[model samples]
Target chain A: MMRVLVVLAVVFATLPGVIVVLASLTAGQSLAFPPQGLSLRWYEVIFADPDFRDALLTSLTLATITSLLAVSLSALAAISIVRYRSRATALIEAMLLSPLAVPHIVIGIGILQLYGYFGLRADLLTLTLGHLIITIPFALRMLITSLAGMDRQIEHAAASLGATPRAILFQVILPQMKMGLLGAAISVFILSFDDVALTVFLVQPGYTTVPIMLFGMAENQVLPSIHAASVILLLASWLGVILIDRLIGFDRFLFRDGPSG
Target chain B: MQVAPAIRSSRLSRRATSLLLLAPTTLLYLTVYLGGLVMVLVMSIDVPPGVDSGGATLAHYRDVFGSAPIGAIVLRTLRDSLATVAGCLLLGVPVARYITASASRWKGIVLMAVLSPLMVSAIGRIFGWIALFGPGSVIADGLTALFGGKPTGLLYTEAAIIIGLTNLLLPFMVLSVASSRAHFEEDMSKAALSLGATPLSVLLQVELPLIFPGILSGALIVFSLSTTNFVTAALLGGSGRDLVGYEIYLDILVYFQQGRGAALAMLLLVVVVALMALAIQTGVQRHEVRDTAARTRGT
Candidate 1:
C-alpha cells in the first residue's frame, strides 16, 4: 500500500509536466493532446516573436536585479540576527518574515495604491521592488540557518590572533558561508523569476515577464505557444535546480532544521 | 563577565556594520513594501472623491459584505482554500513518510520530484491544466468516450482550480513534512510494535502526535497560498466560482473600482494574517509541550 501510494504520487506529480511537453510537440496550431504530428513549429514561433523575446529578456533582467538585491540584504540581516543577542532581534526577525505571511494579492494592491500616491506607475522598477520584498525572507531564512549551523571556532581563533573584526568577517566568516550564500542566491533568483501574483499588478503595458506574458496568452486563448513556453520554463527550472544542487548540496540547504528556540 | 562586555561592544560594532549592510533591504521593505500595505489600508476606507464627495467612509466595507455576489465569492475562496489544504496534507504526509523511510539514495530523487513543481510558475502550470482539461482535450475526450458522458470541459470549474492550486502548493507541504520526519526517532515505532500495537496503530498513536506541528504549518501555508491565489482561480473558475482574489483583480482592472478593490484586498489580508497567527501560536504551544516532555524525561 505504501509503495503504491508513493508511485501514485510520483505519477500524478509528473503527469501534468509530461502532458505539457507532449502538447508542445503537437503540430496543430491549437493545443490537442495525442498530437496530429510532432514538430518544433511552436518553438520556432516563440523564438521568432520579438514580444516573447523581449518578455524573456525583461524577466531575466528583473530577476537578476531582484536576486542581487535580496541576497545582499538577506546576508546582512541573517548575520545580525544570528550573531546578536538583543531585545530587538525577535521583533526584527518577525518583521522580516511578515512578508511571507501576507498574501501577495494584498501586497500587490498595497503597492499599487502606494505608488499611486507618489504618482508612480507600474513598471520594471516597481515590479522589481515587489519581488525583492517577497524574496528577501527566503534568502534571509536560508542564510540564517547556515550561519547558525556554522562553526564559531574559526572566527574565535581569528579573533584570538588579533584579527580585525572586518578582516575576520571578510576573510573567515564570509568564506565559510559560501555554500549557504550560493543556495540562497539560487533560491532567490528562482522566486523572483517565477513570481506572477505581485508582478500581475505591477507590470505595465509593453513590459511583461515571461510568466506574465504566458498568463496574458493563456487568458486570451490557450494555444500551442503557451505549451512551448511551459516546456522551456520547466526545462530551465530543472536545470537551475540541478545546477544549484551541484554547486552546493541541495539537501543540506533545504532540510537544514531551523534553530531549536 | 568582564570579558563579556568587551566582547559585547565588539559584537555591537559588528552588528552596526551589518545594519549598514542591510540598509538597502530595510529601505525597500519600509518604503516600498510596508509603505504600500499601509497605503492599501488607508484606501480601503477612503470614499472615492466623485462618488461620495466625502473624504472617507466604511461604505466600501459595507458594500463588500452586503452584496450577495461578493459575499459568496469570499465564502467560496475560504471553502476552496480549506479543501486544497486538506487535500495537500492528506496526500503530502504519506508521500513524505514513504520517502523518509526509504533508503538514502531514493530520498534525493524523491525530494527532487516533490519540489520540482515549485520551479514551474503557477501561470505555466495552470496553462498545463488548461490543455489537459480544456474543451476537446485528451483527458476530457477520454472521459466522454470511456463513460459515454456529456462533453463538459473541466476548465473554469472550482474543482479544476482546486486541483491546480494543490499542485502548485504541494511542494511546500512535502518539504515541511519531510523535514520533521527526518528527526523522528526510529525506536518509537519499534517500541509501539513491541508493546503489541499494529503498524497503523503505532503510526497513529506515536508518529502522528510528533509530526502534527509540521503538518499544521504545511496546511496553513497551503491554505494561505490557495486563498490568496488570483491567476489559477481567475483562469479556471470562470464566472460560476469567483474567488476573492479574482474579484479584487476584476474590481481594480476591469471595473475601475479602486476603493472596492482595496477593501477586498484588505479583508483577504486580515483573514489570512489571522489564520497564520493562529497556526503559529498552536505550533509554539506544541513546541513548549515537547520541551517540557523532553526535560522531564532528562530528569
Candidate 2:
C-alpha cells in the first residue's frame, strides 16, 4: 500500500512537469501530449519574442525589489515585536500576519481600489506594493522564528563587555541572523515571483510579468508556447529551491521554532 | 556599579530604537492591509449610488445572498475548495508519512519536489495543466480511445479546476504534515503494533490524533487558496461554473460594478478568515488537550 501510494504520488507530482516539457517539444503549432515530433522550437519562439523577454525581465526585477523591501521591513518588525513585550505587541503581530488569512484576491481588489483612488492605477509600483503586502508575512514569520530561537544572553554579554548598541546589533545579532535572512530573502523572492492574482489587477498595459503574460496567453488560447514557459518556470523554481538549500539548510528554514518558543 | 545606571539608559535607548524600527511596518499594515480591509467592509455596506438612493444599507449583502447566480457561485466555490482540500490531504498525508519514515536522502528529495510548486507562479502552473488537459490533448484522446469513447476535452470543467487546484495545493499539505510527522516518535507506533494492533489500526488510533493539527492547518491553507483562486477557475472553470473570485473580477474589470465587486471581495475575505480562525482554534484546543494530558500523567 505504501509503495503504491509513493508511486502514485511521484507520478502525480511529475505528470504536469512531464506533460509541459513534452508539449513544449511538440513540433506542431498546437499543444499535444506525446509530442508528434520533438523540437526546441517553442523555447526558441519564447526567446525570440521580445514581449516574452521583456515580461521575464520585468518579473525578475519586480521580484528582486519586492523581496528586498519585504525582507527589510519584516525583519525589523519581527525584531521589534520580539524585543518589546507589551499588550499591543500581540495585536501588532496578528495584524502583520493577517495578510496570510485574507485571501489574495480580495487584497488584490482592495489594492486596486485604494490605488485607483490615489491615481496610481496600473503601474509597477502598484504591483510592488501588492506583492510586498503578501510577501511580508513569510519574511516576518521566518525572522520571528529566528529571533525567538536566538539566545539573548550573548547580546547581554556583548553589552556587558562594552559594545555599543549599534555594535551589538551589527556584530552580535546580525551575524547570528544570517541564515534566517537568507531564508527569508529567498522565500520572499519566490512569493513575489509566483504572485499572479495580486499582479493581475495591478498590472497595466505593456508592464506584464511572465505569469500575467502566461495567463493572458492561456485566456486567449492554450498554445505550446505556454507549455514552454511553464517548463522554464518550473525549472527556475526547482533551481531556486536547490540554491536555497545549498545557501542555507532548507530544513532549518522549514521547521522554525514557533513564536512562543 | 555606576555602570548600572548607564545600562538602564541604554535599555531605554534600545526600546526606542526598536520602536523606531517597527514604525514603518506598523504604518504599512495599518494603511495598506488593515485599512484596505476596513475600506472594503465599509464599501460593502454602502448602497451603489445609481442603483439605490438608500445610503449604507445591507442591500449588497442581501443581493449577494438573494441572487441565485451569485449564491450558486458561492456554493460552487465552497464545494470546489472543500473537494480540493480533501483531495490534497488524502494524497499529501501518506506521502508525507512515507517521507518522514524513510531514509534522510529520500526525505530531502521528496521535500524538494513538494515545495517546488511554491516557487512557480500560479498562472504558469495552471497553464501547465491547460497544456495537458486542454482540448484535443493526448491524455484526453488516450483515455477516450482506451474507453472507446469520444475525446471530450477536460479543460474549462469543474474536474479540471479541482485537479489543477489540488496539484497546486498538495505541497502545502505535504510540508505541513511532514513538519508534524517529524515530531511523531516511532516507539509509540511500535508499541501499538506489538499490542495486537494492525498497522492500519496503529495509524488510526495513534498517528492520526497526533498529526490532526497539521492536517487541519493544511486543509485550511488549501481551502483558503482554492477559495480565493481566480486564475485556475477562470482558465479551467469555463462559463458554465463561475467562482466567486472570477465573478469579482468580472464585476470589476468586465462589468465595471466596482461597488458590487468590493462587496464580493469582502465576503470572500470574511469566509477565508472565518475558516482560518476555526482551524487555528482546533489546533489550539488540540495543543491544550495534549498539555493537559501530559500534566495529568505527571501528577
Candidate 3:
C-alpha cells in the first residue's frame, strides 16, 4: 500500500511539470496538449525576443544580489541569536520571521505604501529590499538550525591553540556551516527569482523581472515564447534542486532545505 | 581577584560583539519590514491621495465586506484555499509515511521532486496547467469521448485553482508530516501491533494523534498561502472569477484606487495573522504537552 501510494504521489507531483515540458514542444501556436507535432520553435522565438532576454537578465541579477546580501545578513543575525542567548533574540526572530506569514500581496501593498510615503520611485533596489524582507527569514532559519547543531568545542580548541579570531571564523566556523550556507543561498536565490505577487507591483513600466513579465503576458496576450521560457525556468529550477541536494545531502525527512511550499 | 577583572572584561567584550553582530540586520528589520507593515495598516484607514476624495474613512472596509459581489469573491477564495488544504493532506499523509518508514537513500530525491514545484515560477506553473485543463487537451478529449458529450475543460474554473494550489502546497504538507513521523519510535508501533490491534486501528488510534500537530501546521501554511495567492486563480481560473488577492491587485494597479487596495490588503492581513497566531499558539501548547508527557512517562 505504501509503495503504490508513494508511486502515486510521485506521479501526481511531477504530472504538471511533465505536461509543461511536453506542451513546450507543440508546433502549433496554442498550448494544445498531445502536441500535433514536435518542434523547438517557441524556444527560438523566445531567444529572438528582447523583452524575455532583458527580463531574464534582470531576474538573474536581482536574485544573485539578493541571495548574497540576504544570506550573509541572516547568517550574522543567526549567529547572534544562537550565540548570545538573550531575551531579545526571541523578539528579533519573531520580527524577522513575521514577513513569512504576511501575504505576499499584502507585503507588496505595504511596500508600495512605503514607497508612496517616502516619495521614492519603485526600482530594482526597492524591489530587492522587499524581496530581502521575505527571503532573510528563510536564510536565517537555516543558518540558525546549522549553528545550533555546530560543535563549538572545535572553535574553542582553535581559539586555545592561538588561532586568530578571523582564522577561527574562516577555518573553523564557516567550514562547518558550508551545507547550511549553500542550502540557504540556493533557497533564497530560487525564492527571489520566482517571486511575483510583490514583484508585480514593484516592477516599473520599463524594467521587469521574468515572473512579472510572464504574468503580464499571461494576462494579456499569448506569447508562443511563454512555453520556451517556462520550460527553461522549470529546468533551471530543477537544476537548483539537484545542486542543493548534492551540496547539502538534502534534509529529506523534513525537506526544510528548500523554500516552504 | 586577578581572574575577576578578566572575566568582567571578557563578558563586556562578548556582549559588545553580540550587539555588533546583531546591529545591521536589526536595523534592516526595523526600517524595511516593520515600517512597511505599519505604513500599510495606516493607509488601510487613511485614504491614499487621489484614490478617492476622503480622509480617514470606513468606506473602503464597507465596500470590501458589505458589498455582495466582493463577499462572494471572499467566500470563493476561502473555499478554494480550504479545498487545496484538504487535497494536499490527502496526498501528503501517505507520502510522508512512506518516506519516514523506509530506509531508502532515494528518500531525499523523492522529497525534492515533490517540492520541485517551488523551484519553478508560479506564473509558469499556472501556464503549464493551461495545457492540461484546456479543451483540446488529451484528458478533456478523453472525457468527451467517454461521455459522448462536449469536452469538459477544467480551465477558468475554481477546480483549476484548487489543483494548482494543491500542487504548490503538497510538498509542504508532506515535509511537515514526514518530519513529525520521524519522531515516532518503531517499537511503539510494533508494540501496538503485538497487542492484537489491527494495523488500521494502530494507525488510527496510535499514530494519527501523534502527527496531528504536523498536519495542522501544514494545513495552516497551505491555508494562509493559498488564500492570498492570486496567481493560480488569475492565470488558470480565468478572469470570470475574482479572488481577493486579484481584486486588491486590480484596485491598486489598474483602477489606481490605492485606498481600496490597502483596505483589502489589511483585511487579508487580518486573516493571515489570525491563522498564524493559531499555529504559533498550537505549537507552544504542543511543546508544553509533549514535555509534560515525557516527564510523567520517565517518572
Candidate 4:
C-alpha cells in the first residue's frame, strides 16, 4: 500500500511535465494532449516570432544582471556576518531574510504602489530592484552556510605564512567557496528568470519577461506555440537543477534549511 | 578565541572592513523592500483627495471586512486553501517516509524527482494541466463517451486548483518532513517492535509522535502558500471564482481600486503572520511538554 501511494504520487508529480512536453510536439494548431500528429512545426513557429526572441533576451539579460548583483552583495554581507561577530549580526541576518516571509503577490502590490507614489517609471531598473529584493536572501543564505562551515585554521595558516589579507581572501578563501558561489548564482538566476507574479506588475509594454508573456497569452488563448516556449523554459530550469546536483549535491542542497525555512 | 598575531595588529581596519561589507545590503533592503512594505500599509488607509476632506479613513477596511461578496470570496479562499493543505499532507507524508528510508543512491534520485516540479515555473506547470484537462482533450473525450453526456473537463474547476497547488507544494512538505526526520534514530522503533508491539501500533504510537512537529510545520507552510498563491488559483480556478489574491489583482489593475486592494493585501498579510505566530507558540509549548515528560521518565 505504501509503495503504491508513493508510485502514484510520483506519477502525479511528473505526468504534467511529460504531457506538456509531448503535447508541444503536436502537428495540430491548438493545444491538446495526445497530439494529433507529431511535428516540430510549433517550435519553428515560436522561434520565428521576434516577440518570443525579444522576451527571451530580456529575461536572460535581466536574470544575468540580477544574479550578478545579488551574489556580489550577498557575498559581502555573508563575509561580514561570518568573520566579524557583533551585537547587530542577528538582527541584520533576520532583516535580510525577512523578504522570504512575505508573499510574492504582496511584494508585487507593495512595489507597484511604491513606484506609483514616487512617480518612478516602471522600467528595467525598477524590475531589477524588485528582483534583487527577492533574490538576495537566497544568495546570502548559501554563502553564510558556506562561510560558517569553513575552517578558520586555514586563514590563520595563511596569515602566519606572511600573506596579506587581500592575498588570503583572493587565493585561499574564494577558491574554497567555489561550490557555494556557483549554487547561489544559479539559484538567483533561475528565480529571477521564472518570476511571474512580481514581474507582471513591473513590466511595461514591449518589455515583458517570457513567463509574463506566456501568462498573458495563456490567459486569453493557449496556442501550441506556448507549449513550445514552455518547453524551452523547462529545459533551461532542468539544466540548472542538474548543474546544482553535480556541483553541490542535490541531497545536501535540498535537505538544508535553505529557502523553505 | 586566540587570533593570529598578524591579524590582531589591524583591529580598527578589520572593523572598518566589516562595516564596509555590511553597508550596501542594509541600505538596499531598507530603501526598497522595507520601504515599499511601509508604503503599502499607508496606502491601505489613505483617503482619496476628493473623498471626505482628505483625512485617513477606514472605508476600505470596512468594505473588505463588511461587504457580502468580499466576505464570500474570503470564505472560499480559506476553503480552497485548506483543501490544498489537506491534499499536500496526504501525499507528502508517504513520499517523505519513502525518501527517508531509501538507500543512499536511491535517496538522491528520489529527492530530485520530488523537487523537479519546483524547477518548472508555475506557468509551465499549469500549461501541462491545460493540455491534459482542457476541452476536447483525451480525458474529456473519454468521459463524454463513457457517460453519454456533455464533455467533462477539470479546467477552471475547484478540483483543478487544489490538485495544482498540491503538486506545486508537495516538495516543500516533503523537504520539511525529511529534514526533521534526518536525525531520527531507528533504534527506538526497533525496540518497540521487539517488545511485542505490532507494526501498525508502533507506527501510530511512536513514529507519528516523533514526526508530528514536521507535519505541523509543513502544514503551516503549505496553508500559507496556498492562500497567497495567485498564479495557480487564477489560471486554474478562473476569474469567476475570485480568490483573494486574484481579487486583489483585479481590484488594483483591472478596476483601478488601489486602496481596497491594499487593504485586502494587508489583511491577508496579518492573517498569515498571526497563524505563523500561533503555530510557533504551540510548537514551543509542545517542546516544553515533551522535555518535561522526558525528565520525568529519566527520574
What DockQ, on C-alphas, does every prediction get?
0.56, 0.53, 0.57, 0.56
- How far residue B126's Cα lies from its native spot in candidate 1, in Å, is 2.0
- Which 10 consecutive residues of model 3 chain A have the lowest summed lDDT? A252-261
**Fnat of the models, one by one?**
0.56, 0.52, 0.65, 0.57
Where model 4 places Cα greater than 4 Å from the true spot, the runs are A257-261, B1-12, B146-149, B276-299
Residue A227's lDDT in candidate 1:
87
Give the lowest summed-lDDT range of ten residues in model 1 chain B.
B288-297
Q: Would you list the C-alpha lDDT of every candidate in the order shown?
A: 0.79, 0.79, 0.80, 0.82
True contacts kept of 2: 0.52
**B123: Cα error in model 4, Å:** 1.5
Determine which window of 10 residues in candidate 2 chain A has minimal summed lDDT. A252-261
Supply candidate 3's per-residue lDDT for B194: 95
Predict model 2's lDDT versus the native: 0.79
- lDDT score for residue B239 of model 2: 74
> For each candidate, what TM-score against the reference?
0.93, 0.93, 0.93, 0.93
Q: What is the lDDT of candidate 1?
A: 0.79
| Top candidate, metric lDDT | 4
Query: What TM-score should be assigned to candidate 4?
Result: 0.93
What range of 10 consecutive residues in model 2 chain B has the weakest lDDT sum?
Answer: B289-298
Evaluated at residue A77, the lDDT of candidate 2 is 86
lDDT of 4 by residue, B13-77 (tens): 78788878889889988888888888878888999667766668888999888889898888888
- The TM-score between candidate 3 and the true structure equals 0.93
Model 4 residue B3 CA deviation in Å = 15
Worst 10 residues of 4 chain B by lDDT: B285-294
lDDT of 1 by residue, A175-237 (tens): 999988888877788777877788888888888888888877876865698889878777767
